[model samples]
Target: MDEEQLKIMRHSCAHILAAAVTELYPGVKLGVGPVVDQGFYYDVLTPTPVTEEDLVKIEEKMHEIIAKATTFDREEIGLDQAIDFFRERHQDFKVELLKDLKEKGTTKISVEELADVGDRPDTASLYRTGEFVDLCRGPHVQHAGQIGVFKLTKLAGAYWRGRDGNPQMQRIYGVAFETEQQLEEYLVMLEEAKRRDHRKLGKEMGLYTFSELVGAGLPLWTPKGTLLRNILDDFVWQMRREYGYQKVTIPHITKKDLYETSGHWEKFKDDLFRITTREGHEFVMKPMNCPHHTQIFDCEKRSYRDLPQRYAETTMVYRDEQTGELSGLTRVRSITQDDAHVFCRETQVKEEAYKIWDIIERFYAAFGFELEVRLSTHDPANMKPYLGTVEQWDGYVAELKSWLEEKGLPYRMGLGEAAFYGPKLDFMAHDSLGREWQVATIQVDRNMPERFGLHCVNEHSEDERIVMIHAAIMGSIERFLAVLIEHTAGAFPAWLAPVQVRIATVSQDFVPFAEQLGTELVAAGLRAELDDSDEKVGKKIRAAAMAKVPWTIVIGSKEAEGGDFKINVFGQDEDLVVARDQLIATLLEATQRPS
Candidate 1:
């Protein structure tokens, strides 16, 4: 179906849902019911709260209405008549909606006007199904019977029209499909998503927590989460070592002039956290790592051979995010980005861009993620203010396009989405729930190099300006870890698991052996925890499972006497009775990423 037809179908479905609710429960006042991406939802003000059980009954009512195969009829009515009709039915929300639409300069119709009654206010369409009618402009199926399969999925408290000041309305979310099989598949995906929810897994594994007193959108990483972050930092630094990246550190905030020269002061000033010093110099928290890396470039002089200078740093930045947009770990106030910049000759721009892409792909694939690539270009209408000279922009844009084409990489082009300084290739990864996120990005910037007056002495002894490539493989370490938590369902790969092994003893008799084993594991560069609490074996195992340690090595009288450990791997049924040296070697192999 076309987009318009799909929208109408969804809108009609919303009416059906509202009708079902009204039938199942009397005296229900309805708010607006709108069609979303996959299905439709209706907000209702019921005297009694609608529970999960009510949703089931309402869904059954919907199926009964669909079985009736009612035709959808669209009727036009004047604004005054429309208001009066809903006013008589006590649907004050609809009347208010009409008034708000009028305030927004929207035009509609009146039924009285059709009969030539004194200048009818305006006309609007109402879709009718069975005995149910809703204010809507509909393009529905021929009959309600054509709605093959649908399911009520979730319920939440939402404000009327998503405005905070409006009265709170209870929202019921539903999903429909062209086939019953499709609906079942979607339901299965929803279950998987719940299982992989990062908030749920993070809490269960003691990885992170949030507090109302600490404010929303700020996540406090627990000890395990902090350990994971540190390990991730070591991995990235190791990867950078082979790429000719020099590590550098910079403060979290800089004077406003730094951002002004970088143009972030003009473009992203609103999102920045601005502060004033005692001298009244306005400073802003750094949102991007590129400007500081540029300053480091300007600190020295170099020849043409010194071109393509790469600077990599793990930096934390802050942003002011919309309150409603806050999510568990996906959206946050602070981010530690795995950021880098490469200043290279113009001829090497494509090579550097591709190199970054390679690194991003490698890292994501190592964790079993399929990469989706997109090229975000300048949208002339909305992006005219951000970019530089037309010819200069064209040169960089053409080069990026040519590189992608030569590399034979499939990518979608997004218009008007380029960064202020240049065009970028954004790499996206879909989670277990099929939600896509931009996890890595590579951009070619000619403007910054020129702005900084950065040049290298060429073969002809002339100073030639350099081009810069800004790229990040993980985007942000903290966010990536959060994603990883959900992606792995908190059972991280043995290599990256914060506590790789937990040694437990069945009794105090084996406590000494457990401690000794843990120390050995620690010496082998593994994070090992010894559980000698006065808990039963079953309780200790449960605790280790809750912690999401990769392995649980049990040391009982038998194992201690035999001078060996009994290992049980998470998510694997295989158990091994192995020597200490062999166990450490195995772990080392697993932790060593393939080159």
Candidate 2:
């Protein structure tokens, strides 16, 4: 089925889930049920706590409800009547939502589906499925039978309206598809995803670690993990260097005034890590690098010839992310952004953007990622959320759109997805598992320059307001590593692998030769290690395989004397036999980074 139809089916399944839950446990107050990326979830305050083991029972009840083929009847009632209906039923959450809708006209509601009721502020829409009624603005399927195949995935605790101080609710998540086969396929993919989970592989490979004493969401990179991160960052820097980008540095903390002047203090103040000195001066750990980059640009007076000054820095920015929202490397409190900003004339916007685009394409291409482009533009209907005037926004968006067209590249428009500063080209990369991730972005920003009063002298000696292009090849080193680890299942390419070659000896006699060969490999600029521990060759080979090293060389008596080396490549069925010189040459070739 189409995407819209799938969303409808999933949303219908969510209502069915809510209906089943309320029937099984009466007096449960309902919260919003919204359709997410792959499924739907409903937040409800239940009388009894739910656990993973209870999912089977919930799924059975949902199945029973779906079997009845109950029609989903949508009704519009007066706002006061709707509030009274939910209030009588003791669904305080629903009543609260209805009251907010009545008082604020849906402006306060963050739920996209419920936001549709704004057109008729005096009335609210409700959907009835069997004996259960929910406050929703929905275009549901005709009946429960049309919900297709569904399975309740899991349950978790969530705060009401996502605010920490509010009463917590139980969130039930489920997935729905048009057919059983699709559901089965999705389940299989989910299983594979778990197996390829970056956290699991990272621990197994000894890449990184976390400690409670060090705090949550903060990762301590092992030597190998640090190497991996450096390799990735250096790769991006090499590409950026070729494009006339110069490295720049900035302090991690700045006075609150820097952000206030950049408009970030107003928009993202809560996310910033704030600090107060003994002198009672307010400071903030930078949450972003662009604002700092602007200061660097403004430090020097510039002529038109000095336009397009590109400054690149890979630095960590701190954010006070919610504890619950923190995940492994993907959602960490400390983020390392390979950020760059170009201060250029308005006419140079397209050229600078194209340069960054090329860098992004080349960078992701090295890892075999299939990329899709998205043009994220501001919502014209809502001007309050953005910084620029309507004409400026239109011009900036048109420049990016025109660039894409001129390059003959296809992209999808993401309305209302633009950053508050300007429009951006978001590059979504498809990993080996067919999952899409937004990896790189190139934004054409006129707002930040205007806010900072950044300008350059034109040929006519008149001050010309300049534009800034924000480019990040790898949006975050930590998140990109997470994706990369999962993409390769920790078996990175030879050049990118932390330990490219692992040398293990069959006997203690071969240890000397193995060490010599390891030294040779290291001298050849290959990341090599000698497994000289008193372990059996079989066990050593297994350990190397577990570590996902690209190549493992076994040193036996014959190999110690002068026999051809037997190299066991990861994920391969057979060993490669080659002379020592040939093997070294082959490895050197394999370990060469992409040019």
The clash numbers for all candidates, in the given order, read 13, 0
Q: Pick out the ten consecutive residues of candidate 1 with the lowest summed lDDT.
A: 107-116
Maximum-TM-score candidate: 2
The deviation in Å at residue 327 for candidate 1 is 1.3
State every prediction's TM-score relative to the real structure: 0.83, 0.93
lDDT of 2 by residue, 1-595 (tens): 8999999989998999899889888888888899987899999888888788988998999989889999999999999999899999999988888888777676253443343453547988899998999988898999998888888887888888776678989999998988889889999988898999999999999999999999978899999999999999999999999999999999999999998899998787778888899999999999999999998899989999998899999999998877757788999998999999999997887788888988998899999999999999999988766897889899888888888899899899999899989998999999998999999999888888988999999999999999898999999999999999989888898889999999998889888888888888898888999998899999999999999999999999989889899999899989988897698899988888877
**What tens-digit string does per-residue lDDT give for candidate 1 at 467-554?**
8898888887767877787787887888888888898889999888788878888998988889899999888887887778878988
Kindly provide the TM-score of model 1 when superposed on the true structure, using C-alpha atoms. 0.83
Q: Largest lDDT belongs to which candidate?
A: 2
